[model samples]
Target: MNATVNPLLVPDPATDHILGPADARVTLIEYGDFECPSCAQAAPAVKIMRDHFGRQVRFVFRHFPLREVHPHAELAAEAAEAAGAQGKFWPFHDLLFAHQHRLGEAHLRDHAQQVGLDMARYENEMRDHVYLQRVQEQMQVADQLRVRATPSFYLNGAFVDVSFGLAHLQQAIEQALAKG
Candidate 1:
C-alpha cells in the first residue's frame, strides 16, 4: 500500500468481470460500490465509455463495498459474486446498479431471480456466504491500491485521475486506447 509506488490492477481469472472482447488492446478496471451514489450515478457513463470504445477496450469491475456507509453494499457485492457462480454476473451487476435505490436482501434476491438465476442455488449461496472470498480479495487489492472512493477506475493499469461525467472519462479512454 505504498503511496510512493503506483498500484495497478492485476489480471486474474478469479475476480476480473471483463465486459468486452478478451483480447482488447485497452483494459479498464473499476473498483466500485453498488450502493454508493456516485457509483450509481456513473454507471451509465461507464456504459457509454464501453460503447464508445467498442471492441478496442475491455472493462472489469471489482467490488470495494464501504459497509459503514452503505450497509447493503457488501451483501450486494457478494450477491453479484454469487450470481457469477451461476454464470450471470454481468446481468446481476447491471441489475444492482440499475436498482441501487432498492438494495435490500429481499431486493437482491428478487434481482437474482430477475436475472434468471436458480433460486434454490441463489438462496443457498447467500445463506452459505459463498463468494465472499472473492469480494474480500478484491477489497484487499483496493486497500493496497489506496482506493478510498467509489466509482474509481484504472485504465490500462493507471488510476484515472480525471473529472466527472462522460467527456472526461471518454477522453481518458481515448487516451488509453491511443497510447496502447
Candidate 2:
C-alpha cells in the first residue's frame, strides 16, 4: 500500500517557498521563530535529518514569528523574505538561526553582508514595507494551521505528536518513510 500524499509538498503558494522534491517520501513543514530558543535548539536536529534523509525528504520553513515575546522576530522573518527576493533566502535563514541571540537591525545588516549579498540592495529591500506584509501572510497561515508555539512541525501534513526534539523528528521521519 502507498501513503497518502499532499500536493502541497512541493511549493506552498501561501509562503512562496519550495520543498526539496515533489516526490520526496518525507516532507517536514516547520513553523518557527528566529529568536525562539527551542527553534534554535532544533536547528542541529533538522540538519541531521537533512543529512540522513538527503533527497528522500524535503523541508519547508514557515514564518510564525512570535512578536509578543521576540520583538525582532517579525523583522527577522521580513529579512529572510527580502533576501529571498535576491535568491539568498536559505543563507539568510541559516544566519538568522545561527545568530539567534543577536538579532537586531544592525545584526541583520551584518548577516546580509556576511551572506555576500549586496548591502545596498539588501538594505533597500529590508526597508520596503511590502516584503514585511508577505511575512505577515505566512504568520496567518501558521495561525490557521493551529501552530501555537515556536518549533512546531507537521510531518507530511500531520502534526508531529511529540516534543520538538531531534529524536522525535527522526522518529517522525521514519514513520513518514514507512507510510511512503
Candidate 3:
C-alpha cells in the first residue's frame, strides 16, 4: 500500500468483504460496528447511496466492532463471517443490525437457519471460531485508522469527517465524483 494511503481506504486484512460496483468512480468505505446505534442509523443512508449510485459508486463495509461499548459486537461480526462462508453475509449482516437487541448466540443460530444456511455447518463453524481472528484483524486495522466512533467513513480515499446522515454522505460522494 502507498505510504500516503488513508488507512480507512485500505482493504481489510480479514475477509474479502468489499461491497458495491467494481468499476465505480467513487468509493465509500465505512467502518462500523453492528451493535452501535449510530451505525444502525447510518444503515439506511448506506442503502440509499447504494440504491441511488448504482454502478456509479462503490461502497465497502469493514468491521470496527467496538467491543467495549457493545459486548456482543465481536460475536455479531463472527456470525456475519460465518454466514459469508455460505454466501449469505449480507442477509446475516442486515439481520444482525435489524435485530441488534436480540443478538445472542441462539439468535445467531436462528438467523443462520432463517437465511437457509446448513445448521450443522453454521454451528460447527461458529463453535470452531473460524472468523474470530478475521474479525479481530479488522478491529486492529480500525485501531490503526484511529476510528473511535460507530460510523466513520472514507470517501474516494479521503477521510470524511461528519455525521453519518444521507445528506452528509451525499455531499461527500458528490465531492468525490466532482474530483474525478
Candidate 4:
C-alpha cells in the first residue's frame, strides 16, 4: 500500500501556541510571518476553520519570520511572545495580523496595550529580546521542513500545499474528517 507518510513533526504544546482540544483528531499547524500579506489573508480563514471544526481539529502557530524581506517581522514576533508571556498571546497575535502593515515598535506597543498585557513586563521582555531564540528555533524547524514561504501549513502531520488557495486547506481538512 502506498501511503503518504506524515512529514511534519508534532510541535511541543508547552512551547507552541495552540488552540482547540489536545486530543483532537486532526492537528493543523501553520508556520507564519506577521509581515507576510499571505499570512494576514490566511489568519481569518484559520480562525474560521478552527471555529467550524470545533474540537475535531487542533491548530498551532509557529513563527517563521522572513527577516530579510520583512524588516519588522522578527520584532513583531518578539512582541507577540512578550504578550504570550502575559497570557495574552492569542489576542496579540490577532492584532498583529490585523495590523500587519503597522508592525513598528510603536505599533507593537499599541497592540500589547490593546491586549491588556502588563506594559512593564512586555517592555522589559522586548528590550531583552527574550523570545528571539524561541523564534529562531521555530525558524530552524521551518528550514528543516523546507518551508519556503509564510503561511505554510501541515495537517495531521503532513504538509498541505495552500499556495494555490486556502480552499485546498478546507478540502484537506474535510478529507481528514471524512477519513476519521
lDDT of 4 by residue, 86-173 (tens): 8888999999999889999999998898889889988888998999999999999899989999899988878899989999999999
Question: Which ten contiguous residues of candidate 1 have the minimum total lDDT?
Answer: 1-10
TM-score of 2: 0.90
lDDT of 3 by residue, 1-180 (tens): 234777557654345576765667887788888899888878887887888878788777888888888988989898898898888988888888888887889888888899999899889989999899888887888788788887888877777876635587788788777777
The TM-score leader among the candidates is 4
**C-alpha TM-score for every candidate:** 0.91, 0.90, 0.91, 0.95
Worst 10 residues of 3 by lDDT: 7-16
Which portions of model 3 miss their true places by more than 4 Å? Answer: 1-4, 12-14
lDDT of 1: 0.84
- Those runs of model 2 whose alpha carbons end farther than 4 Å from true positions after fitting are 1-10
lDDT of all predictions, in order shown? 0.84, 0.79, 0.81, 0.89
Give each model's clash number. Answer: 0, 0, 0, 0
Task: Tell me the lDDT of candidate 2.
Answer: 0.79
Where does candidate 4 clash, by residue pair?
none
> What is the clash count of model 1?
0
Determine which window of 10 residues in candidate 2 has minimal summed lDDT.
1-10
Q: Rank the candidates by TM-score, best first.
A: 4, 1, 3, 2
